[model samples]
Structures are given as C-alpha cells and as structure tokens.
Target: MSITVEKFVEEGRDPFSLEVVAGHEYLGRIIKEAALNRPGLALAGFFQHFAHLRVQVLGLAENAYLKSLTPDERGQRLHRLYQKKIPCVVLTRNRQPSSEILECAEAFKVPILKTPMITNRFINLATLLMENLTAPLVRYQGTMLEIMGIGVLMEGQAGIGKSETALALIERGHSLVSDDLTVLRKDSTGAIVGYADDMTRYHMEIRGLGIIHVPSLFGVASMRREMHLDLVVRLERFDPKKEYDRTGLNSETISILGADVPLLTIPVAAGRDIAHVVEVAALNQKLKQLGHDAAKELDEKLVRALERKRRM
Candidate 1:
C-alpha cells in the first residue's frame, strides 16, 4: 500500500509534524518505497545510483552545503535532483529551503515538507511509519491476547469457546489484542505482530451475550492495540478415543506467515477450566524461555536416578 505525501503529513505523529511548504497540488504523489534518502551526494552533483523513489531528506549538512553553493549552482542542482521523479523532500530541524530550492520543487512538482525534528529523529520515525504502512499482512480468524507478556493466538472451530476463553483471560487481567479476526504482519526484525481489524477491535461476541465492548466493560487496561505473536493455542473438542499427548515432552510448532510459532492444543471438556489452563501454559512458556523446561528436567532426573540404581 502506497502512502501519499498528504497522508504522511496528516497521519504521521509527533516528531513528524510535517507541513507542506510547496507543491501542495502534488501532495497526492505516491511514496512507493519505504526508505528515506539523504540528498547530500545528490546535492554535490552525484546522482550515479540515486534512490529517487524514496523520500528525500535535507539535513543540517546538506542545508549548509546548499548555502555554500552559488545561486546558479544551487538552482541547477535542485532542478536536476527534482527531475528524477522524487516523491517528496523533507527539510529537517525546521530548516526552511532557500528560494531557489523552493522554486525548483514547485517547477518539478515535488512536494517539500518541513518538520521540527532533527534529521536523524525524523528519518527514524518516518522510516518506521513507512515500514508499517507497507508491511506484508495476513488475516486469520481467531482471537489474539497478551498472556504474561506473550502474544497468544487462539484458534478453533466456531462455537468452540475461543472468545469465551479470551473473555475469561481478560477478566483475569490479561489484555485482549484482537477478537474475531486478527491481522498479522512481520516487522523489520522478522517478529510476527498481531492487530485487530479496525471494525472489530476491542469488541467480542460471547455465546449467550451479544457484542460487547471490552474496553468499555473492562476499562482501558483490558485492551491492547497490538502484540508480537509468540504462541498459538488451539482449542479442540475432547474425544475420548482420540490419542493425545500424555506428557509435555515434545514441543509442537505451527507455521504462520512463514514463522514457526509454538503451538499447544488443549482438549475442551465439560468441566475443564481452559482459561486457567491457558494461563498456566503461558507461564510455563515463560519458564521455558528462561532455560527451564519442566518436562525435559524431569526426564533428565529420571535418567540419572535409573543410572544410580543400576550402579547400586
């Protein structure tokens, strides 16, 4: 998804308090790339392998260099840079462009944005926003919650009590990331992050009850905007004859968007407290992360005891 210069100025927050100084009519220009480029070399007449598609940033050094150039030189350089179909150019540290640069931007229809933040800060924030706006997204029918700081995705057939269990977890102080449908995406570091569909965010539908606003009912702390997906829990109907894992000896994983996430299947029975069980599962996952696996430790202990008995 391409973000236009207009949207970037409007939706981008805080340090990116951008204002269109020129090329207002070209605000609709699409930023097809998710990277930013500093025009230091370009300003110095070096456009050999220029990334013109990215948003151009003019920092303190670039601004000073431009000031050092003769009026004719500056005009020619700005014109050449803008002729590359640049999406937009940002002036950082609230620096205003010279008349020649503004004229070139206007003539070439390149949007010029001014922000109060330093060059590095603006670049970092803008890069983050662009990455999120263009990140690859996948959708799944499930609920996402933060369990002991671990993102748990609950998946199961309809009417299998996914939402009910999520509700229970929320009541126990766990925050709900998303209900019904979850939008998952990978960040720059390759961690899968889950968010709710805008329409259904913070809302859940229970069996006997209608749609309920989670934040309103449980207060703001009960809801979360997004979370990194760390675990997946599938709730299955109990089958007496079905063979299930008797011990937590083997770890299972499920692939989501090309990432292998830890998976757990809990059979649902009439009197099973799935909510409490899931809470324990989340805590156990935390313990495993800390290098203590209860199942593995027990197995090792048993092996050591058997070796001692054999020696005796």
Candidate 2:
C-alpha cells in the first residue's frame, strides 16, 4: 500500500492545502509508511528512535527551535533530518520554509510540502487519507442494494433481470447502491463496502428501457452512493434438477475482498416475485445478525418434542 509523495500531494492538495516548497522533482519519493512524524527530537540532534520511514512534520515548536539556532547549526540540523531517508517533510500552519530548510531539502532530494491547516488537524486528516488510499479494494459484477438497512449484492448472469429486480425493490422503498457493477473495498473496520463507479452511478439498464436514473425518477431516497455488503444473492434460471436451500439452516457465504459475506442462490422463474423474496431475505439476514435464527429455533423445538415422545 506504499504511495509516492506525488500521489499523496495530488490526492491531498486541496484538502491538506498542500503546496510544494522544495524538491519539486523529488515528489516521486516512495512513502513506505502511512504514518506522520514530528522531527522535533531529530531537529534537536536526538536521532535515537527516529521514525525515518514516515513523512516528517515540522510544527510550531520545531520551527521555533530552528529559528533559535544559528544559520550554520540550522542548516546542519536540517541536513541531518533529510539524511535519515524520510519520505518527505510537511510544514503545518503554512509556515514558510527557511532558506536553510529549503537548501537542505534540495541538497538531499527530499520533497517539502506545506499545509495551511494546524499541526494536530493536519495529522489527523492525513492519517485518514493515507489509510483510505491504501485500503484493499476490488471490483465486482453485481447490482448492490440497501433493503431495510441490509446491504445486498445481487449477482448472476448479465441478463438475469438484476436491474429489473432492483427497480422493483426501489419501488418497495429499498435504495440502489450500484447497477451492473460494484466496486468493493475492505475498510479499516474489516467490512466490505459496495460502491458504484462514477461513470454510471445510480443508473440502471433495463432490457427495453435502455438507461434510467434511479434517483432522478424515484427521488433521491431510492439511491445510495455506497453500502456495506451484508449478503450476496446470486440469481439464476430455475432448474428442476438443482436443489435449492428450502430451509435456512444451511447458510452459504462468499468472500468479498477477504471478508466473508452470506450468499444465497435464488432461482428466477416466471410468476415468482423476486423483489419480495429478496426483501424477505434481507430482513431475515438482519434478524440473524440480531441473534434470531428462526430455522435453528424451530429445529431445536422439534428435537425437544421428539425427545419427550421417546421417553413416553
């Protein structure tokens, strides 16, 4: 998940209020770690336990310390900080870089970036940005929906009426996350979130309907930009030979970007209300999450009754 300094700058320029101060060409320096470091100790000539792999931050204290030093000592200390092979240096509070800081950065080929945000706020914001930039991501072929708070991923053959079913669910008050394609990413919480690409977000392509916007037609409540993937439903043409799970006792699951999610193989046939069935499935999944398993409870009750009959 390492990113180049250039990547961080490009992605964080507006948010971080970043402006290149020195070593413009050195923006390509690789960021081996996503954490930030304050070089106060290093600037004071204490190199022990220096976080050389992180992006160096020069806040007010460090800047003031440099201002107190003689020009010769300032240049020497700045040179030492850059020589530690740090990814880059960031000055918070939009503090102007001293001549010595600029000279040392260019001499050692270390990029210097400054942000107008305060030191503590900049650190927090940059931390989140780095984590998001490095999170594991994957692209899936499916229609994503949020039905009654449950995130469902409807996957199947391209023409198995996924968009049609999504439309029905939208009418039933469910929200659409994506149509035809979903981009999944494993966040820091170890949850899989499904989102749509910007190119066709909130747009569904029905066989004869061509392309239609969900939010525009059904109102904004009918569409969601992203939702955590709770269940996966695979739709297929009904085959009499195939044995479907009539009882919910045997649960199936699929892995999305390393997170295991419940999977259901739903048969699509004439006269079947797929939307109603999927909605029920989503509610059932929610019940299971809340520690209510109707199938298991019924089986347990039946077992207890059989045990009593045997004793009699």
Candidate 3:
C-alpha cells in the first residue's frame, strides 16, 4: 500500500466548519484519485499557522480558548494559513468560527473544521485511517514451520531440535516459518497468527552445528515468514516411567496466544523417529478437525460392544 494524505479539521470530527469551495475541491480530488481504499483510511495535513498560534488545542478546553481569541486575530490567522496553501486548520472545540474567519475561508478556499476532541484522540483516529488505507507491512517475530499438515510451534529449552525438526519437515516437503521465538499477533477477528522476525528468519542454533541458515539448506518454499500456531510440540527427553498417551483417544491441549491448541507428547527415545511421529500426529489432528476423530469413534464402538455383551 500507498499512504494517502488526509485533511482533518479539528480531528476529523462531526460538525466541522469548512470553506465550501475548498471542501468541494479537496473532496473532489480525493474521490477522483483515491481508489479502493480500506475503511477508516486517513492521513492528516495540519496547518500550524492558525488563529492564535500560541493557543494550544488540548481536549475539550481547546474550543473555549479559541472562542476567547479576538475575531481580528482569528481572521488574520486563517488568512495566513490559507495563503500557505495548507490542507486544513483544525479549530479545537465545537466553537463556531467568527464571520471574518468564514469569509476568509470562502475567499482563500481553505477549510476550517471545528472538533470537540483532544489531540490524542485526533492522532489515534488519523493513525488508524492511514494504516487501513495503506495496509503497510508489519514487523513480526518467530519462524513458522509446516510439519506435515500441522502448524507446530517448536519451542523448548534452547538446544532442543526445533530447527532440526523444521529442516527435516522441509525436506519432507513441509515449510519453515521462523526458527526461534515467534511473535504472534491477533487479527481483527481475533485469529492468532505467527510471523518471523527479519533478524532470525532463517537462522537456527544447533549445539555442535552452531548457527545454520535454513534457506541455504532447503529451497525457497521450505521457509515461511509466519504461520498460525495450530499445534505445540515441545521436545523433551524420553522418560521410561512416564506412561505416554499411546492412544489419541484423550486429546491433549496447550494454550498459546490465548487459544487452546491440540498438543502431543513425543518422547525422544534413541532409535525412534521422533520427527516422523510428530509429523504424523499433526496430520492426524488435521483429520480430527475435518470431524474424523479416529480414537473417539473407536472408543464409542468398544463401549457399545461391552454394553451389548452385558445385556446378553
């Protein structure tokens, strides 16, 4: 996106006093030029040389102060600003302008808008408008890796094979997002998503391997800037006593970015293909999302069989 300039009369508030000719010209230019703009788009051009330059427009009191300034002072102020050919002058408060100010507006073709809002509110509204109109690129952290069909968040006590699994997944035709920490942001609809930070996009740290670049080892599609986290697979050493959930009957979960993501426990046992298992688990989760819960269906069948036998 391209950033568009907006003229705010007193913070783009309602009930603005605009020079009819100037407003017509400005709005006409905007309608002809600005195309396919996002909603709430705005960019402001503030004219500093206004009536009573010393008058600070702060919050609600701005209007009262402008009202106190003498009419001659205000007229000269508007004239000077109009001569500068600035976009618009924001008259603070709902204070109506004097006749001299209005006449100068009609003659010089400069808009005079009266706003009841403070500077902060005006600035915020302006910022929102600009962003919506432009759709600028946003900075983010963490790498997004597609393991099988699952969006696995590979996080652990550093040194864990996060990048390694990502590399393996990439070799298996999966994609890599970020390598280390991923910064997550919620969209307007509240969907949490991930993206990679530029500094550590393709970089990863393996103890003996040191820092390695992922893109160098794998092709372009192998790396992604960011992805939505659908699963969290924390790799830890295998514990013999820990009875791992061999069955997916009881789906486990972990909270990330305020959403409960399905979780899986993969024990890193020697000779076992941990990465492969994680990949399969992700695939299984995708299936579940499609309304095919394999474990639940099997368990339901077993329960019915037991009930039939008991009745017989």
Candidate 4:
C-alpha cells in the first residue's frame, strides 16, 4: 500500500488545498512513511536520527529560522536536509519556498507541496488522510442501510431482494447507506465503516425499475453517506428441505477487515417480512452491545434449571 506524493497531493487537494510547489516531474516519489516530519532540528543542522523517509513540513517557525540565516548558511542547511533523501516537503500557511529551498528541491528531485492551512491543522488532517488512504478496505455486492442507528449490510445473490429489502426499510424511515454495492473500510478506531462509492452514492436500482436517487425520492434524511457497520444480514432463498436455526443459541459471525461482525442469515420466503426482521435484529444487536444477550441468558437459565432437577 505505498502511497505516492502525487496521489497524496491529489487526494488532499479538496481538504487541504494541497498543490505542488516544486518537483513537478518527480511526483512519483513514494512516501515510505505515512507520518509527517517537522524538520526543525534538520533545518538547524541536526542529522542524527532524522526521519528522512517521511514528508517534511516547513511551518512558520522553520520559515522564521530560514529568514534569520544568511544566504550561504540557509543554502547549506537546505542542501544538507535534501541530501538525506526526504520523500517530499510541504510548506504550510501558503509560505513561498525560498530560492535556496526550491533549488535544493529541483536538484534532489524531491517533491514540495504547499497548502494554505495552518501548520498544526494541516498536519493533523494530512496524517488522517494518509491513514484513510492506507486503511484496509473490502468491497462486496450488497445493500447497506442504517436502521435505528444500527449499520446493516444486506448481502445475497442477485434477485435475492437486497435492494428491495433496503427500499422497504427506507419506506419505514431507515436511511440507505448504499445499494447494490457497499465498500467497507477499517478505520483507526478498529471499526468497519460502510459507505457507497462516490458515483453511486444515494442511488439504487430496482428489478423492473431504472436507477433512482434515494434522497430525491425519500427526502434528504433518508440517505446516509456512511455508517459504522454493526450487523450483516444475509438473505437466502427458503427451502423446506433445508434446516434453519430455530433457536438463537448459536450466534454466527463473519470476518470483515479482520473484525468479527455479527451475522444473521434470514431465509427469504413468500410472505416473509425481511425488513421487519432485520430491523429487529438491529435492535437486538444494540441490546447485545448494552450487555443483554437474550439467547445466552435463556440458555444459561435452562442449564441451571436442568442441573437443579438432576440434583433433586
């Protein structure tokens, strides 16, 4: 998952207003480190233990130091830092690069970026963006919806009614996250976040109908851009020959991006209300989160009763 300086600049353009100030042709520079480096010590001629692989951020204080130094000394320091082979440099507060620094950037072929954001804020957001870019992601054919604050991924084969189930949930006041396809990513907090692709966000397709914009038909509140995944509902065709779990004693789970998510397989059948069942499942998941597991509690109670009878 190596991220290049060019990709970082393009992705951060909208949030950080990042733009290349120098080394345009050398944009292919790979960012070995996902973190930022404040080169205050490097600028002051300290080379020991320098993070040369990280992106160097030149903030106001570093600019001030450069202003205080003579031309020859400034060029010496910039050349020394560039000689260390840093991946790139970022000038914060929209600071103009010094001729000495620009010369070093060109000579070393190190990409230099500039942003109008404050030093600390830009560093924070840029670090976050880097994390997002490198986060573990998985895409699946499914419809995701937020029902009563619970994120649910409805997965099944084609014509299994995932989109239709999502539509029904929408009619019942639930918000649609994504339809037909959902992308899940693990965030820094170790939770899976499900979201729709940019082009298909807030849109759905029905069997006989064409594509429909979710918010336009159901109002703005009926659509959600993303949500923390809490449950996964797998819809399958109901067959009388197959046996299904009648007792909720054994809970099933599926791994998504290394995290075990609660899984429920609901058999699709005539007159079966899947949307209502999924909504209840979501509420049950919420209860489990609050430390109340009905199935486990009942199983425990039955075990205690049988033990007492055997003792008697």
Clashes of 4: 0
RMSD of 3: 13.0
Candidate lDDT values, in order: 0.90, 0.92, 0.57, 0.92
- Give per-residue lDDT, candidate 2, residue 78: 86
Number of backbone clashes in candidate 3: 12
Each model's TM-score? 0.91, 0.94, 0.56, 0.95
> In candidate 2, how many Å is residue 252 off?
1.3
Better model by lDDT, 1 or 3? 1
Q: Which stretches of candidate 1 lie over 4 Å from their true place?
A: 1-7, 13-15
Using lDDT as the measure, which candidate wins? 4
Number of the top TM-score candidate: 4
lDDT of 4 at 193: 96
Which 10-residue window of candidate 2 scores lowest in summed lDDT?
A: 100-109
lDDT of 3 at 119: 52
Across 144-187, the per-residue lDDT of candidate 4 in tens digits comes to 99999899999999998998889999999999999989999999
Q: Model 2 TM-score? A: 0.94
Which scores better on TM-score, 3 or 4?
Answer: 4
Better of 1 and 2 by TM-score: 2
List runs of model 3 lying over 4 Å from the truth: 1-143
Q: Can you write out model 3's per-residue Cα lDDT over 100-126, one digit (the tens) per residue?
A: 656766686545444564455654554
Native-vs-model 3 lDDT?
0.57
Q: Count the backbone clashes (under 3 Å) in each candidate.
A: 0, 0, 12, 0
